[model samples]
Target: MTTVRLPLFPLNSVLFPGLVLPLNVFEERYRAMMRELLKTPEGEPRRFAVVAIRDGHEVASTAPGMPDPTAVPELGPTAGFGADPARAFHGVGCVADAATIRERSGGAFEVLATGTRRVRLLSVDATGPFLTAELELLPEEPGDGSGALSEGVLRAFRQYQKRLAGARERTLSPGTDLPDEPSVVSYLVAAAMMLDIPTKQRLLQAPDTASRLRDELRLLRSETAIIRHLPSLPAAELTRGPTSMN
Candidate 1:
């Protein structure tokens, strides 16, 4: 049960390991986070934990003249630690490695990162410029029959992609080749599907590779069937990948 402390970034979408995450960081709190991360010497991994905000608690930009959206509420002196700030975020998240953090003209940052590994949130601290948390690094386990499951998921995923293309009248991946590894297949399918946040979060929290692939298999078949019956889909509905936010 190895644990590490890192800055936290809560987004409206779920992040799966091995997926690219591009962010438009414009908020003051996140600008400060970028500055802190920049202090790290170059050539080292600049990392942060990205957790999905729970339903009804979406992070939004503060309106002009309004209080800072990232500010922690001032609890009374008698307020106990039992008041969990982590409640606003899902328990499972992915650690992102920032490969490029470019400071913009207005002190904001443009970050290009990739999800490296999964983690479990232990606790969150908000009494700082930005949120930080203690995370327990989760291991990638290839569970029972994951190899077989991967084959099934890949087949279903191809069908799913074809159905999606037919519904939207555009090829989803063009000529992009799918991977063969079980764990990679699971994460790729999880990220590529147009599922809801809770479903993707559940896939991220699955106990092992086989479990994630199993869920993806079910989802691909179900979603493909639904898509096959649909007359057409809106272009917006065909959008995939992480939701880029500022």
Candidate 2:
């Protein structure tokens, strides 16, 4: 297999292809990295790899060098998020392309990236300002009937949408047309529904669509069942649209 080296983004959330993620670039190194990446070929992979930071926020100071800082916690049945040798989660990831950029009030940069394909993490050479690593491209699986969710999941999804619609003060429910397959349904559901960062990252790290859907289905079921007792809506509700959310 061909090997590729890419700049690293160790985030609290997982990214998937055909998905959009927003990144806040405030660190000097990552801001510099962004400037450099902006100069690269656009139509090419425009590739970058992401790993979860186990115990630190900034990689320059906190992330340890050799043993890969213990292992990132796995949210699925397997250690999906912590698989990448260069990172916490290795096998699954989105090869994203920079889509848009905006400057925030505090001089931080906000960027939108659309995930293009999945890549496998092989090794890392953490000798630079940001993390860099060798990556193995993973073959895309033709999602057939893998982890299909039950009708209860669907019903919960609908209520989740309604709750989100009410929170955003917008009647929009684009995700209401979610496909039957577990993968598509899960991503769409997670994208539209309000969930915690760690939970969402877990969904991102799920090995297959079926697993992702199952995890999301569980979360939705729990949330729907406890909606009445929730103290407040998800703090993420303030910004909850595709372009606006992340």
Best by TM-score: 1
Candidate 2, residues 81-100, lDDT tens digits: the string is: 23333435434455667776
Q: Return the top candidate by lDDT.
A: 1
Candidate 2: global Cα-lDDT?
0.57
lDDT against the true structure, each candidate: 0.80, 0.57
Candidate 1 lDDT over 33-136, as tens digits, reads 88999898878899999998777653454232233344433532112223565887899999999999999897768899999999999988877877799999
Q: Please give each candidate's TM-score.
A: 0.86, 0.66
Clashes per candidate, residues 3 or more apart or on different chains: 0, 5
Query: Each candidate: RMSD to true structure?
Result: 4.2, 8.2
lDDT for 148 in candidate 2 is 40
